[model samples]
Target: MQKIKIKGQDYQLPIYLPDATLGVARNLDSLDLLQVGLEGVMVNTYHLIQKPGEEILQKVGGIKKLMNWSGFVSSDSGGFQLFSLIQKNPELGKITDEGIVLYTGPKKQKKTLFTPEDSIRMQFALGSDVMICLDDFSPPKANEKRIRESVERTIAWAKRAKVEFEKQLQKHGFTDDNRPLLLAPIQGHNSHKWREFCSQELQKIGFDIYGLGGWPLDEQGKFDYSFCQKNAELTPKDSLRFALGVGTPENIVKLFFMGYQFFDCVLPTRDARHQRLYVFKVDPKNLNQEILKKLTEENRLQEIFDYTYIGKGKFATDNSAISQFCDCTLCKKTDDIAQVSKAYLHHLFKIEDGSAFRLASLHNLRTYTLLIEALRRA
Candidate 1:
């Protein structure tokens, strides 16, 4: 897919959406995101509902208005977060065919049910351009029976979500040409049998986008490109595919060629906060799809990605910019003016200053966006 049209706006495909999970991209504001070339962000419905609540969001005119951003916004169903909570602490909630039932209180007895309809309603209130359907997240180390159960629940919930999505389109006066796009995730852990089954069933029901659900990892805990490739093949060539929560720069490049056009990941921003910065070993401006494809064919794409640890002792006295090639505020080279110095970043992190976080985040986000720019050209 070259581009995806949602709510009358067209976003260039093979794009990377930074995880602005709570309406903000951590230390960076909307302006900062724009400066880094990010045209879209992914927010979590569960957290926003809990914090600002849906009523406040509606009154404030959704997240875009709340954040003063005009870029594309996609809202995750928050099923992943709920699943994570229950998996970490079974007392928090339980997932059933009806929906997720939460028990939150001092003694874990306060009941609250979150259904597919509830997810759809919340997305509408949030005014998300792209809304995700609530799916049963495949837990780690799940057996065949557990995987099959997750797939079944995912399919059932998707059917409910589709019905509710239609209800929302009508309630919000969204016409067929202006309606928000809804995506359904296919879940089956790593089982091809159930993955195929889930995909076929969801295709019959239909959706604007299909997400590669569950973890994209193998038994040995390595990135499973084979699984992602297989999932891409399960869908039609013209269909839009979202590789949810995926992954490193290399992962993005590989998956893009595999026909996955949309991706959301926390690696760049999250890694930046931890003082880890991504740098292109080769200047990205000098590269394009043909070069990248050649590199991939030669198994040399890994050479393009490198890292700089600002917190390392060696960087304490290094006066060079974080990256010589980056155009972010932290590393832009204009004549002889250096935007930011490695030594200064080291000092800021050493002193635990807040500016260190913002500067580092800007640089990392720019790196991801630069990679996306190259992918777009490809």
Candidate 2:
């Protein structure tokens, strides 16, 4: 496991950060996140500017202050959000080397230029512990030419983002010891050649961390481990890598051994809200490096990892905790009071109660933290 300091706070590697896209992790409050043992959260720079807007964020002294959160905060460059919007409907905007040109207003004629420099500046204003550079995402089925163009643009943008990042550090009077970490995503779709090239170029510009950019899913929507493995290899042995938007419990455990130390994804919390909760078939406390390695090596992760869909009919009358291993509020009793049982949680969801979301989210996130605990030991 790796350990690093961000803005004077300590963080152990192989850490997971849930997405709080707009400075909030959906139904849960900041204290709830801390209670679940989460070390940090990833916020979106794109959505924040659209919602609370920059004026309010700066006035309130950034997201940490705005949310009254004390945990580490990582900010997305907002490049993916813009790219996704344009990809869904090209008439919305276009990607130029200079930046993403988005067409706003009723007629879609009003133009807004969102550049790499703008992303860094906004993230600094948000006072994030880790800041990602804006990058062009390569589509899975992108042609050879398109993939090459994506790599070129990603490298170019990373260069500009680095310049802006340094400028911001100096402006804010931050030193190397106290400055936030900067990450640049490597975009190459499935092409190892382009991915390697992107990595080499970004390394020359020298980003603090390299992100696994683009979708790791194959054309058939299956998770592509080879794609992730190749991306990890592109960076140096000791370099830090962020598995951006990567999935599932199995994915996290598998990727951790492959040399990725940082991860941020929406699966755990999102799945909780959707009534699908993750659980370990065996207690995570029983896991260790040798056992986990044996399971990974023998392709037995499925045996140890599983999920509980709280909405199922069988769960409607089940009185057990969501997970026997989970210490979340819904799973663990407080001062001998009975914890919320699976049956009660199922009823909460059945009746459309908002507390169901919060309770489920807490359980799921706790489950993730438990896994993180086991991995750190590994």
Candidate 3:
């Protein structure tokens, strides 16, 4: 699909949504996001419900109003966060067919059940354009039996989520053409048989989009491109696919070719805060399908995408801008004000200045958006 229509608004596909886990994208605000050319953001349902609570969101008329944002927002089912918590501490919670059972409070004795229905209700309250169904996350080291259980539970929860989604649409007076899009993730780890089963079952239940669930990593802990390709094949050619928590620029380019059009990852912002900056080796103004195809065919995508560790001591005296092609606040120079150079950014980081985070984030976000612009043109 070249584009997706949400609530009657048209947005181009192969879009990258930065993670705004708890109603914010770390250092950047909504205006900063728009300034960096981002059209959408992803939020975590579980986190928002716990912090801001549902009542506050309803009072404020949803997250968009609360954040003063006027762009598309996608809410994740929050299954991944819960899964990680429970995995790290078994006493925290447990996943069942009904939903996730949590042990909260000081003694871990307080019982709270987060069901698939609840996830949908929360996303509706948040007024997300795209909402994901809660699914059992497959841990990296999951075995055959664990994989089977995850797939089974994922399908069961998806059925419940779909029911809840329809109820909300009617209650909110949203029609088929203007309703929010629901997405269900397929989970089965790396097992082809189980992955196929998960995909088929989710397809039967139906959703506007299909997500590539579980960790996209191989035994060596490297990105598993073959697995992503297989998952994309599991869905129809025309069906929209979301690469949840998907990755670096190179990964996005490869997955876009494999038919995955939607992406969300914390990499850009997270890396920015850690002093890692992404830059294009060559100007992307000359990008096209032919060039992209040739680069992929020759496995030369790595050449175009480069990185800079800005916190390094070597950059303290470097007067160069982060990226010559970047048009972010830090990179743009005016007659009176000078562009933020590597030397200044390095000094800011060394002094632990808060502006360092915001400036770096702006630059990094712009880099990602520029890549998206190129992909859209191609």
Candidate 4:
């Protein structure tokens, strides 16, 4: 019932798990760093079930109160994990007409079964703002028989998740004022025909949002962007289209132009932890001869940075201590990339410093939030 509007656009933010360890706590902390651009945080159902257990989270006032975050939150059903788990240990889990049965953890110690109804119940317990339906996924090279089986099961699961979510909402007296939205995922491998079939079928099932175009892109050593675009075209325009698990900056730009409204991935945060940052130039000439000279002296002058540097190896004009391009707090506050230097970050990896993780997480989050803002303006 609590209607959460992101960026004043009547849609939810698509930021996925901050990371594995901290969960919602990390997301809440990043909000300060993200400022007003922060909208929603996404959590993984499979990961949460393994670690904290949904019961514990419910006892702690659900994810939002536990993290003390008021914005929208979404949870992915454990479908993808089941698929990936099958790859690792084919015998680790079994799929039946009803649902999936799997073991959790390194020891393969605990056995748990997740039906579509069960997946919905778990999200309800977590009090997610959006609950995703369970869907079967197959990699690009999946056999025709396996792909057909998975797609059929995925459709069945979507029906179950939707029915259960509606029943639970009614039982709990959920209204537009405080009810969460439900999303259905479309699953099909590389085939355009199957992709269209899945999309058309799921659209009739009726969900507030839809997730499209997932599965291992690297198996073929290149992405099938055309397949993705075709699938996107098949989806209904009234509902939001989310491109799950793919959020490279360039890919995001391309997908946005292709009509995707929501995206989530670990690239920005993961890359920042490895000392990669995204920079954009307001004035091309601000990155002048002097800044290039300093960067050359430091051996940090890459062709990529040539478009953005202002001086002293700093990025973004606001961070230059002399110009003003970005208004982000990190750039406005100080010229201290040392506060989050590549050298210190690399040192952290070399020696495994916990502080480095925190810094990298912070900077990466900032980069993602800023990028989303920029995209919206454009």
Candidate 5:
């Protein structure tokens, strides 16, 4: 699965998709995304349906036409967002066997039923290249009884989602080879027994891809690599694994080795807007799959990746580009008079200019794409 053809477009695998949750990446356009070597993006079905609404997207011929983006697009089923909302305040919604019941209006009286079938239908309307099925997320601190309930509900929802996916495929006239890929997440938190059960059942039901669902963090909020490693092993050797909402550069490197091929995260773009910039610690030219593989094998990730706080006072006087290895718009500026140097970028942020967000985002995204390029070559 080194290369994938989606919506008649070809893209390399082990790819990274920035969160363009609402058809647009913040402060950047479609061309801006393409220029930085982004092959695709992960959009949120929950947000798009609220803002522009479904009718407009269908009328405009989907999100691609509305944004004029020809790149690959993956749509999330909004399970996690709904889960987060409900977890924070129980009054907002509740996850039922039938569907998700969202409470709205001034007093939270209005109710809307969002089922797994509805998720697939909305994804069809969005014209997504990859569609994720809605799954009940296993809470991190759940006991056995709660974890079991989540696993049961997740499988039930996936069964319903599969039925709807087939219906949408026939209705939309998509054939086997040309149809969008469907992915189902494996739930049950960190419980190996339930997680393995969830994996086997989902495999029996079948899906084009399997997702690493649930929070991949510990009580201390650090990444739990053992949990991720076990999840990948639970799936079949040939399955295309998608690590949803995962993570920094080192996390990506480690997971890629564990057999995951797809990833979507808000870190790079979100970090960019927050003035955190990723930079290769070593010479970019020396970087290759073999080199990266060796580093991971030896657990030398810190030697391979690092980031700089561009908002720091020291960078305000630095004359260098954000990253010498970067070929982004801000990094590759040739003319001396208009060079997008660290000093210039610092000034933009200091002045609170809008361009600062776009410029910083370009550099960070290019950093991720560069890493993806190295991984694909292996």
Candidate 6:
């Protein structure tokens, strides 16, 4: 599998699955909907282990064979979920020198322990092309002391994950011909100083890539464009720089200009489910008079397309319009929003329809894939 190099950063472009179970259930066919040139897929380590379990994946000949996906695949350490669990049920998590232990699942039925080493070992079993290290995440608004503590823990975990990965490679007799790469994550909520420090430290450990700028940038507005710009500049040039959990088209455009080479997030697909389509062009010139009037006058257009309240009455259409314009197969074959109407999508939100969720998800995934192609050209 060839690694991608952009502006000196090396990465295997990832097609991310926000949830492993959903990804597996959707199966390999869903990948056909990706834009023509997508490079890889990403799955969650936590969700896979909880639902299908690592053993099932291994028996099915690893993630690649199970999904029948030929391209590269990467798995995230369950660190983010651990953070979420701590917030929701503080009593369910225990932080130790080894790692954090958590009680997971419905009815809190199962107990799973996730140490840095454990994260690496599970990823090894799943046979991902690249695996991320477990890192501590601090909220963007966290006090300086807490941020520092989280940064230190993240560094510690990076070192541990590296040591464990190296040992695994040696045991498996993995030469450069066949060795899985590990991606070290940079932590430090909104503090530029801490972010730089974390990057510098992780560079010394020497992982294949870096997962830059975690959930903080999303949760809080503290780290702006300049923060991402500086962090991308400071990161090692040879390793991949992936801005995790950032997929907004506008944000991606800004980050691409800042030298970021890779990214993964659920926003595109998640937002698509809500009937929000992302079009690159600036606000349509005749939005109010022409588009709105057409929509109001025609029953179908009014039924399918309408002015968006979110973007100051910008013309918004269901997945069908955006999909039809897109080159992806989902749009080409289905021809009209995969048999679901815009009104149905809107109703899905009002009544919560699972079918609408699937349709919207497919559209969003295609939209993101298309956006990446556009960025690559630029």
**Residue-by-residue lDDT tens digits, candidate 6, 118-213:** 889888877887789998876556789988988899999999999999998888777775677788888887788898899889988887778874
User: Candidate 2 on 68-132: residue-level lDDT in tens?
Assistant: 99889999999999988999999999999999999999999899999999999999889999999
lDDT of 5 at 200: 94
lDDT of 5 at 37: 90
Clashes of 5: 0
Q: Mark the regions of model 4 whose C-alpha exceeds 4 Å error after superposition.
A: 1-36, 104-111, 216-219, 281-351
Model 5 has an lDDT value of 0.91
- Tens-digit lDDT track of model 5 for 1-43: 3777765678788989999999888888999999989989999
User: Between candidates 2 and 6, which one is better according to TM-score?
Assistant: 2
lDDT (Cα, tens digit) per residue for candidate 1, span 188-290: 9889999999999999999999999999998899999999999999989989999999999999988988888899999888998899999999899987877
Worst lDDT run of 10 residues, candidate 1, spans 330-339
- Candidate 3 local lDDT, 17-106, one digit each (tens): 999999999988999999999999999999999989999999999999999999999999999999999999999999888899999999
Best by lDDT: 3
**lDDT value for model 6:** 0.64
lDDT of 4 by residue, 1-378 (tens): 112353233643334334322354342374553463566667778778766887798789777787677666678787787778777788788777788888668887777778999889888887887788988875667777877777788888898889999999998788766678888777778766777777778878888778874652655667656766776788756457778776665555556556666776766566655555455434322443344345444645343221221222333222232213333443443545433333444555557666654555555555556555544541
Model 3 misplacement above 4 A:
335-338
State the displacement of the C-alpha of residue 120, model 2, in Å, after optimal TM-score superposition: 0.4
The lDDT per prediction is 0.91, 0.91, 0.93, 0.63, 0.91, 0.64
Of the two candidates 2 and 3, the one with more favorable TM-score, higher being better, is: 3
lDDT of prediction 1: 0.91
Q: Tell me how many residue pairs clash in candidate 4.
A: 5
The estimated TM-scores of all candidates read: 0.98, 0.98, 0.98, 0.79, 0.97, 0.77
Give candidate 6's TM-score.
0.77
Q: What stretches of model 5 exceed 4 Å from their correct place?
A: 333-338
Q: How many clashes in each candidate?
A: 0, 0, 0, 5, 0, 1
